[model samples]
Target: MKVMRLPGLAFILLLQGCNISAPAPGPDFPTSEMADIVFYNGTVITMNEDYPEGQAIAIKGKKILGVGTSLQALATANRTTQLIDLKGKTIMPGIVDAHTHVFNDRDRFGLDLPGAQELLFKNGITSLGNLFCTEEFVAEMRAFEPLLKVKTSLFLTKTFPCGEIQDSWYHGYPATRTPGEVLRINGIKITADGGTCGGMAVSEEFIPGTTGLGDLWHTQDEINAMVLEADKAGYQVAIHAIGDRAIEQAQNAIAYALDGRPNVLRHRIEHNSAIRPDLIPRYSEFGIIPVIFGWKKICDFYPRSPFYEAADFPYRTLIDYDPDLPVAWHGDDPYRGPVNPFIELHSMVTRTEVSETGALCTPPSWLAAQTIPVQTALKLMTLNAAYSLFRDDETGSLQTGKYADLIVLSANPLTIDPQDIHGIEVQLTMANGEIVYRLPASGL
Candidate 1:
């Protein structure tokens, strides 16, 4: 080889000519943003419209960092990051049971508050709406808020047992809409009528066996005044209405509160078990949320109910009328045993009783027509329910910047037969980026 070495300056000039330069004393390579925990190798049903499905998700502090594939999520993992291999299992946003009287479980059934919360976590519920809160209950929850894992939204009641007006216990607690809080007082609750006691306030006569039309706990004017007062005080109002007459009254009261215009307060009609077709459109027109019982069609109360002739639990009718209407679900725990969302999902999907023998307790044809799909049932339990609580932006779905409230399942509910959905187990549950519940190490 010929001895032809160029000088440093000449070499630099040559490199420049080749479109190359000393990687200009570049800035230091930054550290990769790491996740506190990364769940990979599993199906992820992110209810988020932008990222509807994924195979993995990454969590930072208390919120989701990202949701995509295993490689994408794992890219953010460091040595200290807890990498959970789902191993063909499934992950989705945690269940948000919009309504349940679990405090009644504590007082009436002797289930301690912590135990009730554990039960809720085990069932994959990350958030819940405790529909009936008295002053005593509010104080208990305030004391327990620090230790709370499942997010709580309490609706203070003006009446006990859903009837008989008492002092304004709700006046003690302010309506709270702060996102990511463990506990919040969402609104006030009232009963327009009674369902199980043959006082559901029906326009028509009850079935031949029952004596007369159902009873209304409060007259239309009285309910309107109460709802208006609550609305004025910046609190959403939840009214229990089961018969056509009660449903109509509830719609009217909500309309009166909103001055016949739609608003975002999401005032709700709890139960809404029986509604005439004429009243269904009002729910959408007035921005009224129908928090109907998910398993009512198959429950003991539905088949033997006195209210007839009215469209009972007309879920399909309501949804078909307004696809965008927010229809949430409630179990009304303690009154309904097993208080499990999966059972409710199964019932809503199949419109049948939760029978132990697997024999179908077929509902009436009209009731069967109300059956919704599994996806809609899930949304009713999670996102739509969150909307009812005004928490949809905070924790309903697995979206970036939202609380890391999610659950792991043994199987995919979407892939399984609808009848078998209730059997799906919550292998693990994460609330606010912390593991609140997990299956035993032995896989029991």
Candidate 2:
């Protein structure tokens, strides 16, 4: 029940990143000569440049002991070790969702932390960014930390219903400073514009008939100060900007805060739903991460207006503009889409809607041109998302010395037909060497 709660254990592990030289096993690391788990006889997608694909992986305690051939992995296992034959299944790093509102409105969703864990884990999500947190929410997370199996990075809300920056809430939170903690505060979330219900700030009218340009919650000067203050205080800022005007304003503020240079802070423009072609380059120019919605294209959550002009949910344009651009995907769960990454992935790859109710919405013809390859969509959901949370080096990939966060799938996403991707199911989910969720044997 008490998982990896050793004194200074987490702090020592925090010292590691993407370039793991060697395993720094703790004094009480469960086993000294034998691995706790050895998964072999399966296709392993390490996602590491060193070992792009492997046949097996070994885990000692919470750290990945080694990643290589099936023989190499089995060498570390003993009779006592839990040696799992994957039976030709596919295993890869657990899906990391960079942005979601999983914890919000739990009552309406009939969910709690345990329920949230089951929901996320079943979908192969081991890590997430829970935006729009309040002090009360943070407190609830801390109290429920023991029950949390999914890693959470929170972005505290600066105002009521995601508006009006509040300086008082920015200070006095220490445990939230790191990335891989059960619950950590990565930064503050500010709603620069509205979404879904139509307050998105835009230069052109979205609703045709009315003179609706949408709403801008804060002026340029106001957002600039808010971002700069959070940046100086050493917090990543995630702003919810749904429209072109709001996107531009967020870019401008980020540019000013970072002195017009590429930023390492990873300040994000969440739900970059509607953007102009001209604003595409600013993501790479300012190093601002575009946290886009993958399923937005398929859903009629927002009307497909005539004034769209290749401006709504332009993920492909933003991604192809710069090879190094860090474009991440979000589901905005329990709000617009489900937490299932495949639903999002299906939308990104097919440019078609996979609704929660099993109904399909006809996508705009322009959406087809915006579809990305399966590989690109996976990165957006995993590594790129981890990078956005400043946790790429720590947990994104299944590299040696990193936490053993991985999942087993019924089928491989890489080899399957694009149309059949959404059908792939997560057979097993593991986080930090712990098997968090698993389906019945017959389910596979």
Candidate 3:
């Protein structure tokens, strides 16, 4: 049999570095034609610094062609192209979760992949990082990705149960492997200490629950060695620190690791709650990202404490200290948090929660100062989240030449009441310029 010449779509995939399957583009191929799809007449949040708003957007296969006025964008399309009239709807970049936990077996942990897919797509969470995973688990998930709707970024761990590395792998982890663009291998996530509400935040402040001196699994030297080893292996370190003491330890270790070289890879603090006000600057100084869980409103894990104001979350303090300090949000599901982006968004801005049956969420008047602006809250689930996963350049915003990963919202959360933000629904969800999920009434 004679070998056939590769088609335009095959060549396109090779150029884009995407390994997934794709149908062949038409015979005209690349430059001969314009865009594959054009969406116009919408209130588009471009999310680009230069062009922050647009009336339309055009796409070519897996990449975004351009964003501009309806006339400007539509001019690039031909009769063969598919044009979608947004009817004044709101379109923004797809949501991302910086940190979360999931199991290998969907049945285990009562993990419902299909249900979770629908739940996330409906809420506009297009990409998420499973912060709890081993090489074995990520490989299984990667194999099962085609069957799922959402994109994944996996953070592989070298040490779990908060200890030293052995045998070049964790006790129960599989062999090491390189990661792809989407299946990102963001260094190790180690538990430096315990939770806050448990009175184990490693703080000097005492609590009824237990001794405030939380568990420090590794000393600064141990953490430094781990960071050095991980960095050498092409990975960043993510430490799970809550209390001031634990956060300090993490800072020292990371600082030592970054001693002689510039920090090109990102380091992070997972669940960075209960950090003292003075310790906040060190995070930005060290370029350590804090993957904050905004769904703390749903858990009493950080219930009213005399030591809560300056320590618990301290989102306001951090952003105020340095607005440029990158922070991202998470749902932290099946592990003491809600998996709803809306809930996280609302909670981050309102510092409140819905009732058990849902609805009837009231912002405690006393804690009103803790709330952040709507725009700031939106970044927690979008740009900042993607930045933490090193996928910001690809899917964080509605920018030209980026992947057309975006969502159509029923309403713009920026102008609406923060309390009502969680009520917003995703009218449509598109990943890689292709409609992946749409409401039945949408007629897509």
Candidate 4:
């Protein structure tokens, strides 16, 4: 199997942003046209504003031919078409785990990407972006590509593409001049600050008065040089900045990179937990994406450092800025957290930890100011993530001519009570128009 590069197809699709205009197909039910697969009798949430809601989807090979009414999809089918009755199930684009970590020890971690992919199918994840990895992981991903059921992209740890530099002031960019690591290496990741929850998330504000601004890995000048060199060498950059002040440093580096050059492939800020409300506008002005993580686990009602006075994960600010601000959400798990994306999504929408018995696990009014609507949260799970990777056109939503990567859920997250959203089960998951995982028919 060939080693695919990072975000090979999805990056091209990101250029379209949130706009694509197309007229609806003429009213027709069961026209007898040929299709490889036709899913009907289901609620199709395309996530695309042009066609916000759909009834069915028709697929020919890996790509989707059309998304419309159940009768319309059925009409496009023929004798060879694999007609699947969803039985009023809710179908939406597969969840995209935008930020993730597979291993703590990058040198040696015999993790199973194939098995991980299967389990993700059960969770309705058909696309994943591995924000932390090494060259070894790249080779392993290529070896496992034959067994993978989901589309993926990976970013090499800072050390993978370039090792430590001699001069403490000079940034050591990757040796590759043309960014040979395009598909295999999504970008180079660097830590501008530390953690947010009492950890080392470098910031100007200290905890009350103790003066613990966490730690800064590199000076702003050093970061600027590093990003500039990488941009010239042709690799995108992702900087980990949890604190508001740290986010500023990351933004400066991205701005330096874009000086006189175009930002075609998106540069990102990782784990932007304490996003300064003022910097929120810069995200749109600078064309920078945010790969959000840990919001589901900690931001709900946890003890964040008292140094920060604003909303912790200002997702609402990002969404309100552009509605398509390249803000992608993730768990950053298997490295620092759990692998449950839905659990994260649940926490994201509800902003509270609910127990298995459907009880609230935390205080009710802890972080209400940061709560966003379910509609915006769904984009965080799908299209925004795809846009972050520049793959929105290929797989994020149920758009005409897009990949048929979708999932069927037991309940719709939109209409159901927000408290019950996490409990919704994934009845089926499909990638590239092929059924990758399906619940037992009896259970369905």
State the C-alpha lDDT per candidate. Answer: 0.78, 0.78, 0.69, 0.68
Model 1 is weakest, by summed lDDT over 10 consecutive residues, at 21-30
Model 1, span 243-349: residue lDDT tens: 88888998898998898566768899988876877888888888889997877635343343434533777887788898899898888886766767887888888
Q: Which segments of model 4 are wrong by more than 4 Å?
A: 1-33, 103-111, 159-184, 196-198, 204-206, 209-211, 260-262, 298-307, 335-337, 355-359, 363-366, 441-444
| Cα lDDT for residue 359, candidate 2 | 75
Model 4 TM-score is 0.82
Cα lDDT tens digits, model 2, 7-83, are 13223322432111223221112323567898866787876765667777789888788876655565566657787
Q: Return the clash pairs for model 2, or none.
A: 18-393, 176-185
TM of each candidate vs. truth: 0.88, 0.88, 0.83, 0.82
Relative to the true structure, candidate 3 has a C-alpha RMSD (angstroms) of: 8.5
The CA lDDT at 371 in model 1 is: 85
To one decimal, what is the Cα RMSD in angstroms of model 1 from the true structure?
Answer: 9.6
lDDT string, candidate 3, 1-444, tens digits = 101222443344336553322122111113333678877666677666666677777788887877776555555566577877776678889998777664333454465766666666776778887776766786677776776656676667655654545344632332233322445455667767666223345566545464546567767777778777776776767887777787888888778888856667888878877777778898888888888877665333334456655576678778888888788887776564445677677777888775445755554443556677878878878888888887777888886668888988777777777778778778888877778789878643
**Candidate RMSDs in order:** 9.6, 7.9, 8.5, 9.3
